[model samples]
Target chain A: MMHSRAPVNAVIMPRMTEAVVDVRELRKTFRVSEREEGLGATLRSFVSRHRKDVNAVAGITFRIEAGEVVGFLGPNGAGKTTTLKMLSGLLHPTAGEARVLEYVPWRRENAYLKSMTLLMGNRTQLVWDIPAADSFRVLQEIYRIPEEQFRATVKELTELLELGELVHKPVRNLSLGERMKVEFAAGLIHSPRVAFLDEPTIGLDISMQSRIRRFVAEYNRRNGATILLTSHYMDDVVALCKRVIVIHRGRLLYDGPLADLAERMAPYKIITATLHDGAASSADLDAYGTVVSREEGRVTIRVDRHVAPERTARLVNDLGDRLADISVEDPPIEEVIDRVFTSEQTTVSA
Target chain B: MIRIYRALLVAQIQAASQYRVQSILWMLFAVIRPVIFLAAWVAVARSQGGQIGAYDVRDFAAYYICLSLVINLVTSWNAYEFEFEVRMGRFSPKLLRPLHPIHYSVVENVVWKLTTIIPLGIILVFLALTFDARFRTTPAHILLFVPSVVLAAALSFLSSWVLATLAFWTTRVHAITTLWDRAGFIFAGQIAPLALLPGPLQAISLALPFGYVLGVPAEILRGGVSVSTALVLMGGQVFWVVVFYVALQRVWSVGVRQYSAVGA
Candidate 1:
């Protein structure tokens, strides 16, 4: 909306051709009924069932273009996975209008299911006792992939994931990371146009995580597949998503560039500096910025974006001899989110 | 669907191969049931002048042996499998797949029995020798019984599918399955032939699909049924298979709806 005549809108705006995914005012609530243990409680519940409703996702709306990879960001219980389940036809919204790739997902028709894939980490779909290749073969049948196409895709994915050595090992024998890689290969062998990855790298080590990240990125690039990724690790968001949608407490909080999010919630950048002398006065540092922490001339400051350059320049020019080392950095993404979600509870504008 | 089943079968076999000790243990251990029944029935026949319900002890031996072999082939463990799969959230992955999950589970259950059948057959053979029971070979009986057992397998699979899908509602389909298992055991003629049960229980056996799997086929194999009567019972198995299949479809839709409501 800020860019009045956005050029990217022409080719990429999810248009009349049919939004690949459209969700508006989506809502889901669970009726948590109290169950009495004994005969008295049972009889009481029969007459007066105490019901509590937990609103998992409340009045959320969004759209995805034909081939956009959008990151879904939210703290646990913020309804990110709930939304994903609705999109993938695993769950239905209690009240809402929604569509995925031109089909009502809760219907979960063979046609709609054929064109989409869901991959979740930690919870496995593979047969635990079998080789990963065996699991992959089963997927081919489930998706009704043509023999040749299934072969070709399995070959390509196996090579891309470097799964040759790992694919034949029994699933129970494979390391967690190895199993996840093969899970991806099995999920994607059908070459679905839409992929929902929920915490797909949840428990993987750094190297394995990056390997999966690269594989996903490469797959998207090659096929122009639309992706909806959810992860707790902020680095996953930073590495994979250009556009992110943030939700908190079952409500949409922010939908925009990730960089803009960090900028908006945390308006100030962090700076750590060490001085030549341990006796630098804390009061003197206030002129430069809000002194977050100062210890033996190892001072930390929060400098507002507008004043960061001038403040740093002054600190350098005025305290040349006193300053030993200075480094300006962005606060961790988690801190930015904590402020946005917990501290300021700002209503999201899409 | 068949293709999906074949793949799942291959995978289950691979999984079974991983723990050779456990796999063998399961085979040797579960084999006790048929032998126990065989012994009990043999004792009954001996006390009753080597016959009960027109079966000499030798005939009872042959009947129970064949029952054990075919029952082992046809029975499914989905009721137990679903309890775990549903309770632990393992059922989600199957819902995510494009194929009907029943196919995956059905194939795996049948394949697992392939290993157990030998032990079952061995126990049955042992009974045949010890009981001095009437035993006979009839090409006609084999011809009719084979397809009856297969149809029985389908019936068993679909009934359990309906039962397992109830997880979406109560989350404790396990308790319900215990009843189903007991009913299957009694009415399906696991403990004894339908003819040997009291009159009222026999009526209930006829009303349910259980006897069609174990009793009807085993009945014919023991020279109990005329070819015409055998034809009618086989028709009954086929009929119930359709009924159970349709029931499975209805339960699946309702279960899926309930699962959606629960956000499962």
Candidate 2:
């Protein structure tokens, strides 16, 4: 199973633009020590321990053009974080190559580091006991930002994030959302050309998540920075990213525009009809398409994407006045991505 | 680089100032071991008819008093702190920064010393007056002691940083740091003056970097060594500083590679 590598569905970039972040077959394999749960085994293992090679990031490849906000989508342990770490220069790849802004990431040169930023939602660089503004000053010095530029950037971030007095409070005293806003501001203080954001909205309330999503979109618009964002929240991806790269089990499963993902993976659409006087039953809907659900007076069915309009028209004509309300829509992005992973499994097993 | 260091120093000082009471308590706690050693040595000297190997009660008082201050000035807890940072994944953010993470540690150490210095100085003065300790120091010895203490601080910090880099390879650095502190306790003349140790042990202490970290500086401050001897010891301190610095750089490069390969 460890050696069962999946083929990559590479995304082709336009020839007119140079890729800001380029990766080719980037991989990272880790040797992990293993031990069984037993005192005798533990005692014996002290003398001769066992280890296994686990490929956290199998040979996967993709590219992002400048000013593009691309979603890096994958489930847990799908090597999404590993690939981001490699691209951000926090982890070295065991093989293959990656370059950000034409600099080899693993070299970790000052110029390269200065031009990029990686923000992990669960981690923070702010000093816990002090006000976040103090930490920003330290970062200003570390990045050697001039006084005028530093003040201007801070003012801009404060206005954009709505962090008026929050920056003055000790970081430990601030709420998680407020702290994250400051973390984002601190990361952007240098105005990096490339940003890798890992789960930026992992545990925020819905309203806060919307605010952050908007901030990211606006930041990208203003700076023209290339952003690679990963989030389990499908809303973030659907709202902010026009294109997405989906990886599964250390392999690139699909990479294309977010709109095309459902067409390619699901190739189906959903149609819902609210009938009057409970006129249509599940049995009646099955004739039109696959009955997805029948709750109360409404019936939902799945049909081929190309036949969705025909299915809807037939339902309206057959039911006539009984069809009080009707609508046809594409499947949710989450369901499409789930099918992508499950179908890939079927293909691999076959 | 200077701007970065200054900024880091200001930030660390501000953070440390918030815990002034805790800092004072920790500094007082550090005085305990030296005070115990001082009492024991003074007792031993009194029992041995007011003198034992050139150290009378007053001399023991002066020696241990200076030893306490010197140890406090040069001590670094970075090995333990680094281990915790690595285990908790706190080091990852530091790695992402353009500056080396060691600069943070270095600045934190300096701030810790700065915050504790005035209080520790008062404690040292009180001990000196309480014990009626007399110093036999010349102007020349005082001048040389300045450089000796500075060199000692550099050597001690670099050595601790070198040990701290081991955290990249192993999460459990407690045992290693424990062993290091134990060796430093004996060989750095924390428990006793290096001159009073057995011939073989004294030679071993001199051969190790620990002696230069605390022992030699304390001895110099107490006016126990000649000017030429002090210069020679300073040279040794310089050599160990260079050695530890080179070792730190080499170990850090290798350790970061290991970290990047295996991850935090």
Q: Which candidate leads the pack in DockQ?
A: 2
- Candidate number with greatest lDDT: 2
* Positional deviation of residue B21's Cα in model 1 after best superposition, in angstroms: 4.9
Q: Second chain TM-score per prediction? A: 0.91, 0.96
lDDT of each: 0.79, 0.88
Model 1: per-residue lDDT, tens digit, B1-264? 667777777777777667767755776555567668878987877887877877777776777777766667777889888878877778887787666777767667776787666665666677677776575646887788778778888888888888888888887688898998888788987788778899999998988887886788777777677778889999999899999888888888878877842323
Docking class of 2: medium
What is the lDDT, from 0 to 100, of the residue A10 in candidate 2? 45
For A1-350, candidate 1 gives per-residue lDDT tens digits of 01122211112223456678888878888677878589999889878888888888877777887787888988888898889888999887899988998899888888988899888887777788777777777777778889999889988998889998898887889999988998898788889999999999998999999999999889999898999999988888888888788877677767777777777778888878888887545568877888888788798999998888888888888888888888887778888878777652432332
The global Cα lDDT (0 to 1) of model 2 is 0.88
TM-score of 2: 0.97
Model 1 per-residue lDDT at B163: 88
Instruction: Give the chain A TM-score for each candidate.
Output: 0.86, 0.95
lDDT of 2 by residue, A1-350 (tens): 44454454445555445889888989888788899999998998999989998888888878888999999999898898889888988887899999899999878898988899999888878998899999999999988899999999999999899999999998989988998999999999999999999999878899989999999999999999999999999999999999999988788888889988888888899998898867344466788899888888888899999999888889889988877899888899999989888887787777
